[model samples]
Target chain A: MKMAIAKQEVRALSGDEAVAYAVKQSDVDVVAAYPITPQTIIVERFSEYVHNGEVDTEFICVESEHSALTACLAASATGVRTFTASGSAGLALMHEILYVTSGCRAPVVMAIVNRALSAPINIHCDHADSMVERDAGWIQIYVENSQETYDSVIQAFRIAEDPDILLPTMVMLDAFVISHTLESVKVLPDDIVRKFVGTRQIPLVKNHEGKLVPFKLDPENPVTMGPLDLYDYYFEHKRQQEDAMQRASQKIKQIHDEYGEITGRRYGNGLINPYRLEDAEIAAICLGSTAGTAKTVVDQLRAKGVKAGLLRLRAYRPFPAQDVTKVLENVKAIAVMDRSHSFGAYGGPVFHEVRHTLYDAATHPQIVNYVYGLGGRDMPQTLIHEIYKELQKILETKRVKKPVRFIGVRE
Target chain B: MTAKQKGWKELPIAGLCWKPSTEYFTGDWRTFKPMLDEEKCTKCLICYIDCPDVAVKWKPEDEKIEFDYNFCKGCGICANVCPSEAIKMVLE
Candidate 1:
């Protein structure tokens, strides 16, 4: 079911540059962001676009990440497209407003260059920053490379702004790995991207005056947003957020397939991308750039008659529980690799979710957790090979002696 | 008759406050209510300007001042701000 790609040009761009270029062509109305490592280039390049008269986006340089997200939330409340980027401490600083943005249904799209959280003050790549905010009600998408970064950034706006799923979204790229490394990205023409994104469709809501008006902060038809809700209605609002998240699983896939038809590029049904897993006896599940390396390992294992496969999770927030269950139900054993660890929890975030997702399946695979590459540590091909080997051994032993293992770390 | 409360599905997508704040009757929580002494009251309208809840009502055409006890939290700001000591805080 492959479709022909329309007119496109191949450009060598890093992950950050790809996000900026996609946002520039998407015709975002406003961008408010504070600069941080790995993600700084995105706003910096977009500001250049603003200066060169390439795009008429309102580029706002805020004092801090908190104010940056606050400004974007306010701008988005006015019913216009808005974007921002952050990583590491900057993402952490914008933590409080993340909940506010999604709770208010602002539909603001952000690019998070995945970086290790501080204390050690490392600026390298890891999922800890965004992974910690997993419950903040944001749609999270992790990309494998610069090309996916570019494609996903364009798709994020449509997914977040869908009328049925007006939730904020975060497009993640590994810091320094994809953010600094350049790759050949096929970009659709500006007009095509513009046409594909179209305009945000705001739903009509009844204001206090009993008149139906667009759900935005308009002087002509005023409405209060992010109002204080006590016990009387707070639970209902939280339930509505959960319902929108449930609906987002389907809406994201629909939007992904629609975009694929126009560009001939699609990632595994827009939720989890399965690689060589059709007849695989053993598989490894991971998120972000590590999947690219793991795929090479799987190919090498296949060459040696190993029935190994990889399932790269693209969307983490929605969890894609049913799809994951259907895909891995028959596999003999699985290794879930997480770049971020949940302190005092049973395992890493992805491992816990995947195991929970498979709890009721007809066939239970011997699953293990591997916390790897914290603080921007490199996950080489050998480590991925080690994981597959461990899975192979677990399949034979019929038991997991250790449910969790720290990869590439000295005892 | 009271309007029926909305279910989660029928309510606005987010917890958007579309109804005016006047919809909630906060005065029920008030233990002390403000009482005005019209005899000693000047036409200064100090209570009307000092009330935080906008519960003090003053009509320019009628040249009259009244209290909207429905929303008043009885903070006693009006009684404290009355220059002529024309307002008193009475237990509800």
Candidate 2:
């Protein structure tokens, strides 16, 4: 069914309120999340929905994200749609169960308000937390603004629950950029959202008594899920996950396209969002909220007639290896702007994977890594411009001391 | 029309420290064993339901079942689930 957008008054909403609207629009049966900032307000508002009986969901106040997702695990197992949200440390707490949620093939979608991992304590945006968890088998969808944050999460449920792609997915927005930005989001009417999202009818296997139950997951389908996967079947499980992931990238695109048809909102989901790359000799690769700043830099560079483009990665896991190859193969030079770094790796962790994806290509772009915005460093548009100019010099010099550059470093 | 593959393994009380001298499990005396009746044997599927661990593996094709005591924490679920009265609990 086509969505009917109402001419609702354009009111400013915090990122958390956008998430609450998305959850209610999707008609999520359960919201099991704990308190953590900037994420605390999301569930706090959801708790209000529970008390007011506006949303008939089991709004569970879990002890931790681990417990929240664990309860979501059992809840999703019984075949109810579920949601939860968390930030850096809370995302870290649910690390082990994240694998379980995906391995069990539970289609649980979550919103992650991107926060810097705590030590000296910063609560703004960075790619460190989710970037480190790139192999956890959940599709990571990054939104640049609050409007996309509100939209992507509802599509997260639709994509995760699609039978062709029954895996968990995480919708991410920077702690401040989208999480704090107020935009005029055209939220589809709830009933229209319902039409786009059909009611879930899980197959019921009746027990001997009149009451029905799910038949035990039988091996007769010749599918052994989450088994020990000893040497005999180990490679196949990895292969299946990889296969499912490649399929998931395409699935994400399909979901985005369908959501586009419904609400005139579109997201390019093949790892990177390419802008002005049609025939550019140089481009900047970025992820998360940095993309918003990077886009401004791209505009300034273009205004100066600098042949530049921007590749904003939206899906980070399964690392979009193939898609990165196709997009970056033509550009003469590329500089990766990263917000997180591996302590002693050749470059920041994000740079390492983007390079790996291009390793086997026939020809490769001159890729360089720039680690910026560490510990809440303010990476404004000019610094991003300076970094691109530096990449220009490196490409011009044709010789570099190292492939990776940590931009905005005081030292 | 055809029989499913039936696999079995002989589990021994080694490394697990199944010492008969220790009269109670961890000295709590809550753990017990479900003694099976060799005579009054009707293969009813009750004990499988009551096992908290769901440890009782009743093979419908072969009509044979076995238990791995290592994982069986003696919850006595099988004793309660057995409708044939073919099982009884013996304290550790």
Candidate 3:
């Protein structure tokens, strides 16, 4: 069912500004954040909104990222929409509470400006910040551009707050590439965004007194959240979280489709957005802004009758294993690009998951991992073409001699 | 008798504990128990104030202080804090 696209205004905004715009229009009740590189602009812009009285959100400037998400978690527990943004070391600081927020079932929406974790203190694009938290039980969405960043941030709130899946969500945009770069983003009017996100519907739970009340920290009817569940019940709660994550894949698709109806813009099923995968003999799988570059490469390869395709992973937490399998089933050779590499591991994080996902398939493609662009390195078009050329060699040879290769790196 | 343990689906989402903490008997974990001597009690209520688990029950109407061992972990804080040394800790 298709609905008419809502009227929108075109604005040149950076990826950070796009997230702020979406949160501002979503009528977020609270925003607690600490300014970090690339992610700082998001809170800076939102703080301006708070100062100008543009929105009624309580903007909290926390001392550290840990306190920022901790405050957001507490605020979200009270049944109000909350938001925060962080990256790199800041995201690392919030690592402990990331699990606590999801375990408490607080639907706090966060924007992660993906940045390289510091060893030499480099502030550049990488997936290490968010990828490390993949098992933290939050719904993770990676966007290709500023426009999708704006659209996904709005969709994230609805997806997280769905009663069937009350998990915290983090929308990731590449640092510098998307966060600092300006692009034309079509933003829905405030009222339309508000109407689309709607209000957070608090589910009812039985209280201590056996009275059914809304699931929130209410003084009138108190309930303990993030309480101690030792051996007697800890495993069951974890299982319940897994259940919600499984439910989130379908919920994300549903919400993405619903948003598409109003905006007339949709990524491929909101899980895995396939670009020219149909009837292609070779394809590459990637995440974040790299997809934008890979798409151009795929188009170029297709022009030369190379039958090359690209599969952009939009949702990573739910993993979208089924969509990935279906999209790359016919392809003979594939490349899994990782902007972040797992030190001393067989391959990057994405490669491990993608390989494990296809282990049970009837016929598996010759899949290889290419760990590239770590610590803000540039992944030019020529490098992506090199990856495809490598895939072509793998297809002809029908064997993977070296399963993991680091591209564009002097090794 | 222990109530039936809830299955994963029946458990509140995210393990929200709506039931009071008293439902779990912490006394079973006690390695030591606090014994009170009513004659040595000075009614200072210091033990009641010091007990972390609120196991030291104080009935102000009758000026009676007693220990509710059911919820007590037998931490011995009350025995340590008792001004009159009315409470003593012994192996349970």
Candidate 4:
């Protein structure tokens, strides 16, 4: 089945600008953000819109990323749509509240310009920032370029605020690669976006007193949020979040399908964005801007009669395990590229999950993990080609010489 | 109780505290209750503004402030805030 790519006016925009425009069009009630590399432009642009009276939004420039998220939590608890953005250390600083936001089920939308986490201190593209928080209970959607960044931000609000899934979501784009790189993007009119996002759905829940009340901080309803729960009920609350994530996987696909009907842009089933994976002997799986690069390599290899394909993991939090198993089951060999390393683990986060997902499959493909593009290092087309060549070797010999290899990094 | 046993029906949706603070009668926790000495009492109403819990209520018939013992924790903040020493914390 072909995706309906919507016809609209194309605007030249960087990924950051695209996200900013989406936030603007979303009619967000509040934006609480702190400036960080790559992520700075997003809140900055939105603040300008707030300043010029282009949109009605409460723009809060907080002292730290922690406060920025705290403000978002407060605003979200008040039953209003809220947004924020950060990267690298900024995201790390807000790590504690990230859990609070989801645990509280605030449904805050955040734009994450993915950047390398610090040791020696670097501000460039890497998945380390978002990958570290993979288990934070937030719905994570990684984007390929400016267009996807724009599209996903709008969809994120719908997905997050869904009654079944009252969870926060982050739209992650590779730092600089997609965040700063300019591309042509078709932006939907503000009214269309406003109608699509609609009003926030704050479900009524029964409290301890057995009264049905709005699940928000309202004076009339008088509900309390973020109370200390010990052994009596904390675990049940976590399970609620888990069930929400499972429901989210299905809801995300549903929202994407409905969104595609209007906008004509769809990511492969809203989980895995696959390119020419059918009848392929070799394949590579990655996320973010690298997928675009890998697809280019796929096209080049296909011209030479090599069966190469690409799988871009659009939704990372849910992991899309079933889709990965179904798509990669037939391939002879596969390379899982990760922009972040898992320290001393067997492989990077994506690699480990991909390998684990394939274990229960009827057919197993020779899988190799390649740790690449750390610290904003360039992932040239040649490196992606080399990975496919390595996959080809594995197919011919039916062996994986190295389970995990560092790509473009000195040993 | 274990979380697994709580079940979906019993789970609190979005962590909303089911019991609003007002619902809990904290008066039982009080070790000392504020006793007003009407003879020495001044009609300043300073105790009304200084009561942390808003437990001090103004009686229209008496034209004096009376504490609502149902919600009062008896922390003695209102007694201390009383300038005329008209109110004092007494053992419950």
Candidate 5:
């Protein structure tokens, strides 16, 4: 008889449940939360955990999203991990404090739970809220499915707490698509989650001969922070943030690979996850929940004799300029599906930036944006096929379609 | 000597050099300005306690308090929250 080795089992979970599971796994000593559209349920389960004694955390019921983040930041700053969730108006309230947490480099992990911004108050699925905060310095990882949402939440702690990148991250998941949807997921055990995430070392603090001195700053050897800089250190500060942003990409990728080893789940966070683009003519560049639809469209298009591919973006921050240029240079056409509109000048924020990044390149593909799903419009996979066909037409005739291709809308 | 230079000797302790006739965010010039009326006054430290931004300071001598305007943003909350109604927002 052959001896069998002991191995752990995996289970299925919905996005909200997965989030609660992830929060539990992160060993979050404090849970600060407020009720907001789409993201409310994620914290609802967390509250249940606290009530049932499933999670031993100081669950702080906050008045508003601003206080939720403030409490999370304050808690995490004092040498313990913290978690929270918000979307749309709630996120807007927390906007100013987001930069403060980033500036202070607090490793408070949160789930943005992507939803459409208010006014008419329609909430389903869109990247509007998350895209609006592109420069908040929070490392964003947009997930496509419920399993990935759960997985991304777990991975967020590992990535955020990395000493080289002691920065907060917002795991952005589509409101109804992933946040409310149910899917089979492998929820890692708490012990394994603890082992994988490890302990976080609080930032800007160091002990010297029994005295607690701040790490990133000097008080006894004093230095002022955020001083209104003239020409001297202004550029240097910008360069410092840019360098950290650059370093974060590689750190994120390394953590992804490590998580893959430990948990058998990995996310390609290097801006683009290229599918069948090795010898393809056109590649569809997309981000967030739309990538799932685009991937299916790519398979169908490929089956019907179209030499096209997919580049599902996972990490939009520290935008992967070099990799995008290198991979997209030789392609005849690249259709960027923009779920977020930039109002004018460009169709969407991600589409606008990607087009600009690839514009000056020698053999770059003709980039066209398909701005779809605004105010929670339906984006069927068949529309992605139509968008790709339109891209093919644009490739044949070099005529730009007003810099935007609005697909399947009443207007 | 000019009256401005002569004024320093007349001041009590820690001869004040700060100005309040100028402003930052709010335009009320003497918004945080110290008024040493030395009349109709009970110099309680209530103003200092109500100041969220710590714009007010309490001095020990004669229980009098002076304002520092070099860093004050002239938020006007100080004057509005003053219990004694001693501080007033005035145009420069």
Candidate 6:
């Protein structure tokens, strides 16, 4: 007999609400967080669940985002499922321990409601928050909407807790674009979610007595965690983290497919969600909720006999470079959209990665970068259409006259 | 051997301080050692309570204290806190 898939319960929820519900169902043992815009709703909703006796979780409202991550790190080290949520400033505050959490191989899952970093202090959607931590060694999955946010949160636990890929994972949803917007999301049933996420699978480590014990903060096993190492072993520890990250890309796809098998929903291979790229000459790449708008534009352009396509990047870190190269090989010209800038770099972070990934491709497509939607600025479908128009121009000219351009904003 | 030379798997999980800390033997850093004067000691046990290193060992039966010189860094905080002037820091 075939294994029967769990029935998904359809409920209308905001991105933050969906994430909190997923965390509740995952049997998370600890949630420590400090509130910030967009992400505040996630922790706030989870706290209500804890207060109403809906979940038996230790909800720690930490004083700072740093302490929040530290608390989650300590709890996760004890081999329990742990979670936290934060946005721009909050994520920046947790920067130091972000590496510490992943470096210690603590599978602490975080929902980063992507928001712009501040100097003028704006609370809005942007990839700047998670993008800044791109090199921090955590597995990153950017979701397009509330449904994907909820589903990714559940899958994140499985991927992070896998023994071969015990690194922290960040499930990113755009701030106001997804986090604050309500949509109908199909959530897995409570028992089904519990069974699917399962229990934490901690590996065994040797104790001082040479006896094997579960690797955690166990009294019987007594293993020191996060010890200071100057140069003697620091490099080797970092190398170990990178090795785990390299292993994570495949692990993410496996877990994503496993979840899809259960719920009947999956992003394209759990990394790159390509739309209308099969016979397209011009394509635009983006992430988060903007992909939804871009997909609409792709359909609109297609009706007019324009071979326009969109590649919605679902996973940013441990970038699916080979997969991206393979998918974009036949395209003539491509436009990479970035919600965040890289200061003085060649282009935005995502654009740079896509360009580099295609550098060794058998067929090179003229790629251009558009740094748009900074500081929660609106990305109208017209602007995305203009991006495609620029790609069309590049295709006709066979060259990128302006390699990097800003969209919609007056200079 | 330093951890840099080890393979990723060979390195201890999470850079855990696996070996007992006693193996490091921090006592060699001591420049001064505390000398106990039994007659001057009031049995206040101030030295016992104030020591950060747990270097001061108490003998409850005899109502006196002893120093474990092996682990003590000999910071002389005990001598400063002693009201009875029982623990006098002497140059090693």
Model 1 interface CAPRI class: medium
lDDT of 5: 0.72
| Candidate 1 chain A TM-score vs. reference chain A | 0.99
Error of 4 at A67 (Å): 0.1
B-chain TM-scores per prediction: 0.77, 0.56, 0.78, 0.74, 0.52, 0.77
Error of 2 at B27 (Å): 30
How accurate locally is residue B53 in candidate 6, as Cα lDDT from 0 to 100? Answer: 92
Q: Write the per-residue lDDT of candidate 6 for residues B1-92, one digit (tens) a residue.
A: 11225566776667766466665456767899999999998888888899999989999987889998887898999999999888888999
Candidate 4 has a DockQ of: 0.40
| Sort order, DockQ high to low | 1, 3, 4, 6, 2, 5
- What residue pairs clash in candidate 5, if any at all? A12-A185, A204-A215, A205-A215
Model 3: clashing residue pairs? none
Model number with the top lDDT: 3
What stretches of model 1 exceed 4 Å from their correct place? A1-4, B1-3, B28-51, B54-69, B74-92
- Tens-digit per-residue lDDT, B1-92, candidate 3: 23678889888887788577778666767889998898999989988888888888889898889888788888889888888998889997
Give per-model TM-scores. 0.91, 0.77, 0.91, 0.85, 0.77, 0.85
Ranking by lDDT: 3, 1, 4, 6, 2, 5
Off by over 4 Å in 6: B1-5, B18-92
What is the Cα-based TM-score of model 6?
A: 0.85
lDDT of 4 by residue, A14-105 (tens): 99999999999998999999999988899888889998999889999899999999999999999999999999999999999999999999
Cα shift from native, residue A279, model 5 (Å): 1.5
lDDT by residue (A211-260, candidate 5, tens digit) is: 33443333363323333433423444445455567888888787776666
lDDT for A347 in candidate 1 is 92
What is the Å distance of residue A387 in model 2 from its true position? 1.4
Mind listing the fnat for each candidate? 0.74, 0.00, 0.80, 0.78, 0.00, 0.62
